[model samples]
Target chain A: MYYIDDFLALLFGISLLIAFWKVRTPLFFIASGACLTIIYSITLFFISETKPVQDIIFYSMACLGCISGLLFIRVMLIRSISLHALKLSNTMTKNKKECSIEDQLTEQMTSEIGFRLDDLQQKGFATLTTDGSGQLTLTPKGRVIAQLVSRLYRAIER
Target chain B: MDTLFIVALTTCILLAPIAAEIVLKGRRLQSNVKRVAPLYIVIALCCITIGAYTHYPHPIVIVMYWCGYFLTWFGIRSHLESSILLKMLTTLQTSNLSRDELMSSYLQSYSTQSRIAELKNSGLLESKKGIISITPSGEKLLSIIDLLD
Candidate 1:
């Protein structure tokens, strides 16, 4: 049990270090988990007489750590979804021409906007034309893009 | 106190992109999901590390964390969908065509049910006597679009 605990600790420590080194934003969660661990370890080390306190600290840290781990998984899942959306958009754009405004918009969207029309459509951000054709129409929600672009233009002008 | 401070600082950093997006471009918060996931993951990972070291054995913690994460994810997804619908409607409003013409054009081009659903959801258009017209809320949202000019 001692060896296993040590191994887990080492793994977490190494992960924390890498997170810091890579400037991984997710490191914040890991760091939080580490801090909880440190607190528990310190309580166990210094408060040997206070068994109840030790237990409480141990439980609290464990709870926090588990929660953090689950959150990390969720974040990963969201990232995967976003990546999948981008990939789908890229694949859709890749098969088409790029010189026209529509193609240019699609290309700019996949490359710069990091989203795809299908994803938007599915999400209610946009919709497909009803003619059983591949035509895409921006939904009202998509109107924000024009607003966002105009804002950028205004800022640049300023 | 220390933990709270760290958490607050971290949350602020994590939310920076959201603030920037809203202020800089008036984009919906959901649009930044790809960039924001890492921050949430980091926070989650940190909690896990803390839990393991604390030696607390409770499955409920993990469940709660995941539930919260998924809730936030879905919330963002819903918001993104709404934003897209809002954008399309605003574009149609600005075009040179009449409301009937725009509706017909959109109907001819896009799925009517989805378009109507989006409009209804966004509070942009109301249906009465089988006709739809822009609502006050819709006007407000569209006003933002005009402000872009």
Candidate 2:
């Protein structure tokens, strides 16, 4: 019983780490959560000697662990996908031992955060002008997120 | 196993940040190590004190509770400091822009100067006479990442 929660938490963390790197889909996260739920239920069932309150505590902590792991993994994956730092490092490799970018992102900035707006378009945050003018309009979902982020960013800056 | 102790533990985990923030408000609290130490010490002392006081302390569960608190704090701090998504969304909030314009605007507004400053501050990259070079440590760090990826 003493070592079991430690083992279970480790198992859950490994499951989440695997689920995240396995694919881009949300299904894996859901599957990992489901697996964790099953593990928790089975473990609690076997440790039935504990009273109802203790069971509640155990389950509550297990639930928190699952949610925390899921959220943490999501944040980490998003960070990895950004890869701006990697791009900068890659750009530095061009000039042998030294380099500089004083002009256009295309010229010397390497990727220059060449993060495509198609990403936002695919996420439904931005829409292209049909004439191939490349102008973007924010979707309602995009507007909502933009508003929330603006507020949060302002608050943090303050 | 004490209900009150568990409740206190959870409450402390959640509320410690509010207390820390209040302490950090007007003064540019430089030593985050010191800021974070108090709550951690309090939690540790609570775990030990509870064991002595009630003689029914669960070490693993209490430690998990502490982990939850620390991770929660870390996640919030990380997001506030480095969330590109948040910064991007905020950039988009101001105006309707084209693909090229949007990317360039974000890069101009936040990415270039700040990233350069951060990289330099971290000692990973250095600029000498307008030429930039990665330090040996930075090269080592990138190599490790190359291996991992």
Chain A only: TM-score of every candidate? 0.29, 0.54
Residue A119 displacement (Å), model 1: 19
List lDDT for all candidates, in order: 0.44, 0.57
* Candidate 1 RMSD to the correct structure: 17.9
Which one wins on lDDT? 2
The two-chain DockQ for each candidate, comma-separated, is 0.03, 0.34
lDDT of 1 by residue, B1-149 (tens): 13543354346445643444444353333433445455556655655555455553232333343334444444543333333333344444354333334434543443334444445554555555554445665556445433421
For each candidate in turn, the interface RMSD (Å) is 17.7, 4.9
Residue A5 lDDT, candidate 1, scale 0-100: 35
For candidate 1, write residues A98-148 as lDDT tens digits.
Answer: 322233333333332233323555777456557655545566665666566
Chain B TM-score of candidate number 2: 0.60
TM-score of chain A of 1: 0.29
Off by over 4 Å in 1: A1-158, B1-31, B49-55, B59-64, B67-71, B77-149
